[model samples]
Target: MDHIFRASRQWERIQNRYITEDAAVDLTNLKSDPRNFKLSLWDPTTNGVRYLKTLAYHLGMELSPAELARIRRTPNREIGDPTTVRCGGETLCMDYLQATYEVGFIEREIDLSGARILEIGAGYGRTCHMIMSNHDISGYCIVDLKNTLRLSKAYLRQVLDEPRFKLIDFIEVDSLQDDSLRSERFDLCINIHSMTEMSPETVRAYLDLINETCSAFYVKNPVGKYIDKSLDGYLQGQEAVEMALENGPLRQLLDIHDSQAVQAAVPAFIEGYRPGDAWDCVGDSRALPWSYLWQALYKNPRKPSDG
Candidate 1:
């Protein structure tokens, strides 16, 4: 949280200096700031964190307790601040975006009261923030790597008034390791678009973990095949018509199970359309990245094994 809070501050400064500044002010003035120099030039919306955190990460510097405390006490002035989010250029109310994304994808409104749920890859505790702000799920744990856990804990403290809803639990063993998350289980386990950034091998392990951990789980962004190394900057570009088609690793796995969509995008899977069919799933109608909200559920009836 402290990291995110600090990152948020740095991000706002970036917006103020670069995005909002006029041409008269020398951009060199902006260059002098150590924080700005640290960020690798990726836009704020894409990376989430600002240059400070990246600098600390690269330099292997840890914030002292006093500095951490100061960051923790940093006013939550940006809590309700309006900013344009990455998705659809929507002017999202921070307080409501979390709740709305869940509601939109969950296919139902949430009532977490007395419900125990676990969210994998819970970045910045947005899901926890949304759930807590809206409903009363018993309590959810923000389980991630140690660094993310620490960062998210500080974020919750800064922005959230009652940060009781999220428990900061760091997974010691690798999240992809089978034995790591096997013993723990919950009512609902979720992996939103978060898994998109994971390595291909880890993605399989993540899916396996979710399948084993909870009776019912939600997996959005199930199409992982088109993520090509060459498409790094061009995946969403208009040159796909001329570029040689490549399948991402996830598609191979899904294809074996006959779940892979012949088309690059996933609406084909939902609409039961195949490649080269009379209708195309790739052209003008395609929604890159956010087109289909794949909500797969695992439902296994309880066996008669005596309780």
Candidate 2:
């Protein structure tokens, strides 16, 4: 299988260099051979935009002038809760990524029950709701910028009314070092799509803080060898991550590292999900199903001091 995969890659290079125009059209005739289709999909040189458009058209998604306008105005903000948002034309809904990992977490039974969970980028508290709703757990806390914290508090209050769930709360702090934040500790820390919002220095600082104060941590982010320039929010380079990790404070706290596939949350498609003050645009925000969710866990090796 290794040799076959390698040879397949080599043939793709040849096709990209020598054959351009009729390659896709010709390949359709070769559909009987599954490897040919796989090779085409894997070809880096193939234009993904064209490919995706072709796929969408084949799936019978037609856009009228009004629908196209709706898509155009659809704000690209994070959907903390998909159930509340209206999907104008997208085929999939929320819970796609959440459900997959829920089963995985359950099978693993990794002891999330009643843990003092912390989610870094608790945008509108959707992921927070996932943890609190699904797992058998104790309490969860959210740390976010003042703007997001305000929006999340409002959203949660409107959407839910249950007593047992008081285990969840929101905190507003400037930097993690704000006297209020530094004085506290949590059992687990989570960072969803929030890492990209900060500078490398801030990421390292936050990681160090988590290491010193928290017992365990989880992060789901995009990292690896290949850099896809076309991604909507892909990192410019890997150095930001490297610099953060190499800095001493982050190095000591984390024990294990795991990389999981996260769907890149495309804000362009979501209605009402915007960069503006979401609180001000409550009824008017456009949102699309954002696919970015990664889960990485860290175990605190040294016992935290009982201060």
Candidate 3:
């Protein structure tokens, strides 16, 4: 999968550093605080710590002090310039809180225990860290850019054992005919925030891979292709009215004339269960706070298609 973001100078700089990186690379902001270049993951600067409390309330997640302490542990502390606030006598980053919500959301439907898992485009493996720290999965595989994999591998190794997880670079997954991963199987595959940054062809390629090897899939991304200032060109973007986002930059970008904006998904992203589609929708897509992103769960229990 040729990620569209890989073409950016930001990626190239990070990629070079990964090869010549030293001890300071451990605190590289490429994963956590890339100035204004988020790549796909949100850090404390873009996603402030303020909204996490409200997100918890909306998720209706109840946590005892002990659980909160466990859940809010900041794994990215040594990775970037993490912005932390003292909450409930614990230092927590907003990204960790969001990762916690993501884990909670997934565990609500499926049992992750001993479930072989794959997370494509995992940022710095924050969500992966959250899951592995809390649940004992059979094995976890992360497929991402070499630059990202390097950083995530470093960060994850700090907390995770080498044998428990595997990191595969995107270069290893070439074309639909590639059978390099044919021997592997997973109970679940997940992509968060980054799929929308990929081209339609790349996105479709991942779906094909998921359809082949995984029993279930989860994703949190925007539904439509809207203009974004950062990337200049458009990728799969979020819709305003669809996610019920308030009047803001996203609503402006959709060029809406009414109280709501309606736009169809370009290139036909498989976001939910529709008749004739392979996936069975687990539930309705839930909107993320203050953004056009929505989360959905889908399952395909049939044999991998041979076509």
Candidate whose TM-score is highest: 3
Candidate 3 TM-score to native = 0.62
lDDT of 2 by residue, 1-307 (tens): 4544344676767667645556656755464343454545544345554544444443224344433333333232234433222334453223323333432332242366656666777777655655554456667777788998988777665544465347677776674444555666776666755664466566666766676567655554433212334442336466754554443212222212222221222122121111122211112111122223324444554644111
lDDT of each: 0.45, 0.47, 0.59
List candidate 2 segments past 4 Å from native.
Answer: 1-92, 99-103, 106-109, 175-178, 224-295, 304-307
> How far off is residue 218 in model 2, in Å?
0.8
lDDT of candidate 3 at residue 269, scale 0 to 100 = 33
> Where does model 1 exceed 4 Å of error?
1-77, 80-99, 107-111, 162-168, 172-178, 225-289, 303-307
Query: Where does candidate 2 have its weakest 10-residue lDDT segment?
Result: 278-287
What's the candidate order when arranged by decreasing TM-score? 3, 1, 2
- Each model's TM-score? 0.49, 0.48, 0.62
Clashing pairs in 3: none
Question: Looking at candidate 1, what is the lDDT of residue 244?
Answer: 23
Kindly give the number of clashing pairs for every candidate: 7, 18, 0
lDDT of 1 by residue, 1-307 (tens): 3544344776777666655555335466554343354454454435554543454343223333432332333334256343423322222333333334343344242234555577767666666655554445555655576687776677777666664534435453244454776787666666655555555455556556655565445544445344333324565674662232232224432331233353444543333212112221211222222333354433323311110
